[model samples]
Target: MKIAIVGATGLVGREIIRICEELLPHEATYTLFASSNSAGTKLKVNEKVCEVKELKEENIETYDISLFSAGGERSKKFAKSFLNKGSYVVDNSSAFRMEEEVPLVVYGINEDKISKETKLISNPNCTTMGLVMVLKPLHEKYKLEKIVPTAYQAVSGSGRAAVESLKNEEKLGEELKPNYRDGFYTRPISRNVIPLAGNLTENGYSDEEMKFVNESRKILDIKSLIVEPSNARVGVETGHGVFCSATFQKEVDVKEAIDVLNSFNGVQYWEETLPTPLDAEGSNDVLVGRMRKGLSSNKILNFWSVSDNLLKGAALNAVQIASYIVQND
Candidate 1:
């Protein structure tokens, strides 16, 4: 099998290469693609050096699978072309996520949503990925009606430039000027938390916040589930943390909920210890903890979930989809 990773030099792209090297069969070969400026750069995959190529229309058909983390514009432009050439695409950007024909999938929660005929799959946003992992089991038993989630996301979610800005802040100070290449972020990301993530929509919710609502509903197959989300950027550099209060149609038993979480695939629950960014940074599993009854009502349950934004939240999930395709084939 041959795989092509677009945006090969980006943070998520690099992590995808590492995961592909670790999990994919050794017989598979990988090709890296980047912009013209980065095209000739060398990248190491599975300890083997490979030169990054400029993505072109002519070369997209050479791979069986393509993983895209090259921002939405690139994915919008190139993903369909790759799919048209018979290569399955797992896009990490928001490009095709809400498309009626595209299946927004999380490996354990909604792998069944993918079919032999499906060629393009969308990876959920980092915050949504961790949130739904914990919500899936509970929703199955209790039936979720509404959810209010507040995400404390990492700098890495923005891009390498944001990560560099945070590092520079540590060396300089919080007042450091915005140096992000694209000016993607509105404020400094170090020593403080920014309440706004992504652009604010006309309805007042930021794009990142709405992703939690829209993507969760799609992945859970719940069209009417009410989701109110507040997404924020924190000083942390790796994992994403989500705190949510979920209201159910029926009464929930905390013990049963804990049991359900423990039994769920791709999630781990702790009773005494709560998961943090430090605990989740290098791990593939979504670490869930602090499960209890919500303060407001008996029908509402509150919990915390954490996962490596780059791993379970992005690269690992995409690779898992690729692996599933290979296994099924």
Candidate 2:
């Protein structure tokens, strides 16, 4: 089967290649595409060298599947072309995720949303991906009433440039200032935390914050669910974490919640420990810990959820959706 990896030169794109190598069928051949600047780059997949091609209309080709990690604009421009050519698409972008017709799927949670007849699937935001993995079991056992999530996202979630900015600033070692505000983010991102993640929308919510609110509701199939989120960017390079206080319609039991998290396939629970960014880095499963009753409420459940933004958060989730299509097909 012919497969295409759009944005093959990017951080997540390269990660998709690595994951597909590990997860997808070995007999499947890959075609790589990227922006003009990265088009000629060569990447290794399964010990074979593949050259990246410029993504353009005339170059569109048919494939059994296409894994896209390019940003929204490119997905909006080129994803349909791949679909029209009979390729099933698993997009890792905010674009097309909320469309009325497109299914915003979190594999293993709502993977049944995919059918053999379905051609396109959308991956949720990295933070939302990890959040819902933990939330799904809880929601299944107890009806979800609301979620208040404060996400501490890694710089790598913003891509390679953000990581570079953090590294470059770290070099200031002794020279770093308290008000050192510059570079890719609105404020300094080294040895510090920026309370604002994405650019704030008119409603005073950062785009990233709103994404958690919207994507969670959609993926969990709870349209009326209330979600209040605050997103912050941290100095760490990878692994996004969300501290959530979730209120459920039914009374929750801490032991039962621990049991459910432990039983879930893609989740790991640290009953005796809490996970940090370093602990969760390089891990595919969403690491969850600190389960307890929320302040003043038995119906409210609190927990910490974390995952590798590059793996489960972006690349793995996209490929998992593609794997679902392949299996069901």
- The TM-score values for the models, in the order shown, are 0.95, 0.97
User: How large is the C-alpha RMSD of every model relative to the true structure?
Assistant: 2.1, 1.1
Q: Which stretches of candidate 2 lie over 4 Å from their true place?
A: none
- Candidate 2 local lDDT, 185-298, one digit each (tens): 878888888898888999999999999888998999999999999999998899998999999999999999999988999999997778988998889899999998978888
Quickly count the clashes in candidate 2: 0
Score each candidate by Cα lDDT: 0.89, 0.90
Cα error of candidate 1 at position 216, Å = 0.9
Judged by lDDT, which candidate is best? 2
Count of residue pairs whose backbone atoms collide, per candidate: 0, 0
Candidate 1 residue pairs that clash: none
lDDT of 1 by residue, 198-286 (tens): 88999999999989889999999999999988988898999999999999998998999989998998898977777899999999889
